[model samples]
Target: MFDTLPQHLELIVLTFLLAGLVKGVVGLGLPTVAVGLLGLVMPPMQAAAILVVPSTVTNVWQLAAGPRFLGLLKRLWGMLVGIVVGTLLVGWLLAGRNWPAATPLLGVALILYALLGLSNKRFRVAPRHERWLSPLIGVITGGVTAVTGVFVIPAVPFLQALGLEKDDLVQALGLSFTVSTLALAITLSQHGSLLQADVLGLSLLALLPALAGMYLGTWLRSRISPLAFRRCFFGGLLLLGADLAIRGL
Candidate 1:
């Protein structure tokens, strides 16, 4: 939030609305969609600052709504610690220093993430393998988050590869996202990139539309084909991500 309303206030509101819709329909993508779309006009970090509240509230809710929270947390403890270490290491990128590479990095991350979603590839990580790979992926994901303000690159893929049931997978995503959001918030506060208190209220208002859109999307989920919708969603991300990547380059 700024001292005054942003020139593109409507766009920002709509962006959150759409992002919420996506998350409601698919279970995730609020940060990915919101940061990527908003990046077209603002730095990814700025957009990410606005995202802290909504992402945290929603993700915390998601994490709590699942019965598997404790189990997931125990299994993901190492990965969670790694996320913190990695985010702190690269937090400088967002510490009052919007490097030229950040935007491009975000674009590239979105592109890679979109491509992975669209590819329909499935990976498996056995328990033996998870012992080492979990923390590694978390660190990679945290580094990516610190650089790009988006948190889903390797983390999402790694989570998917765990071969959890549908409910467990959803809950797992919630846990990871909640940790990542809090980690990013802490880093941003340490640097004041998250914004000052006066205008922070404006960003919180975004939750209204986001929650509303999520409600709508939840209603629509049973009425539509999620598989078809997801393809379209990833396809759109691919195009948008390419545009951002090209502009950044």
Candidate 2:
């Protein structure tokens, strides 16, 4: 167990906590930041997998705090459906292959998403026309979640564009990730990708740090102006995306 282990274990735990704090405050970023930093200490796949539980718990916290469950439900109906379907399909397709091909794809997607966020016109969904968009978004989200575990960004923008209130946006992102994580967890189990007992222990150890980070982020958010907060959030995305793209090359 990491608790009883040596120096390396301590580093990973600290990293997870810092990553969690960022996510807690900013409302996104667990996968991108944590995975990138932790990858230096552990294998990338292992680092990515370790995030599942903390991310799940944090989202659960956000959803509970938003107190907009019902409204989120009404607004996110399509997106919720879309994420579930997409994750399952993508997970199935990822079975038994080398994951290298996935890196560049993830990088490109992140870059594109960053560009969109920086643009003045954010993407929006026609909430009234739910006949197709919901499922499409779900499938796309699922696929991306399966590949990179960072699909929340795309889903969040769409929900915001749908004109959901801030609380609703928070709830919707939380709920969407909750569903996507569940599906991804199952996929990992089925694919035998979650084999390391030590890794799981490390993930558990990381939870405390995650909680601390969340608190810090929440406190920090209160201090920042809304406009500055928005710029910082999108700027972080842009930097993370650029990092991913460079790594992919």
Candidate 3:
């Protein structure tokens, strides 16, 4: 059945499907799963390039689903600015370099994020301190995304700390991810990593499988326990992350 497609393209489709499924179940992890798994067969930059359209499309869906868009934006603009500036500056400096050196960092980040998720240790950021701390977290998250192509760690934790309601939290995450995806795309374009015709075409094509998987996952989410699924997802990420770290080393 798969014989007609190029091997790499087939891999890309499968990876996006899995990534989208994870996202649908957990409301996150699309980029992390896609980039982490795709890195096995392609450079991280290429993986990141392919993620642009799918990530943006899904996140936009996520971002649009909530009622708190303006409020979240008002509160998060500083962090958003920091994300853009930080990603652009750092990504420009590191562009065109061999990507393997960065893979271990990506691996370590995934492991840490998984560990944090598993620990269930909640960190709170009081409302009074948002003015300063928000931008700081944004800078750190942006820097990490620029290098690793994964944007979860501090960003996810930071958003969680804000004490948003369940729906609001998910929406905030979607907004943050959307911004990150856009910024990452610009950074990659500046670095000339996003201009390849095949990469662009594949990224567009991958969206179909990604959305299909998301729909399937959403259906399954209604039937399954989210907590149980999340545990499995984190466990899987931990193992994959460790493997990537080992490979990078």
Clashes of each: 0, 8, 0
| Candidate 1 root-mean-square deviation in Å | 1.5
- In angstroms, the error of model 1 at 159 is 0.4
Compare the candidates by TM-score and give the number of the best one. 1
Using Cα atoms with residue i matched to residue i, what is each candidate's TM-score against the true structure? 0.96, 0.84, 0.95
Name model 3 segments beyond 4 Å from true.
Answer: 1-6
Candidate 1 residue lDDT tens string, 2-96: 43347757887999999999999999999999999989988887787888888998998888888888888899998998898888778865565
C-alpha RMSD (angstroms) for model 2:
3.3
Better of 1 and 3 by TM-score: 1
Rate residue 176 of model 1 by lDDT: 93
Candidate 2: 10-residue stretch with minimal lDDT:
1-10
For model 3, how does the per-residue alpha-carbon lDDT over 1-249 read when each residue is reduced to its tens digit? 112225788888899999999998889999999999987766676688888999999999999999899999998998888888878878888875655578888889999999998888999998899899989888888988888888886889999999999999999999999999999999888766454666777889999999998998898998999999999999989998899899999
Question: In model 2, what are the clashing residue pairs, if there are any?
Answer: 17-209, 21-213, 82-138, 82-139, 83-138, 86-139, 86-142, 87-142
lDDT of 2 by residue, 1-249 (tens): 123234577777777777776776768766666765654444344555677788778878877888778866876677777787787777778773437745555566666665766675765667576556776767777777777666764665666677777776777777887777777677666666453566566667777788888888788877877556656656766676666657766
Residue 154, candidate 2: alpha-carbon lDDT: 65
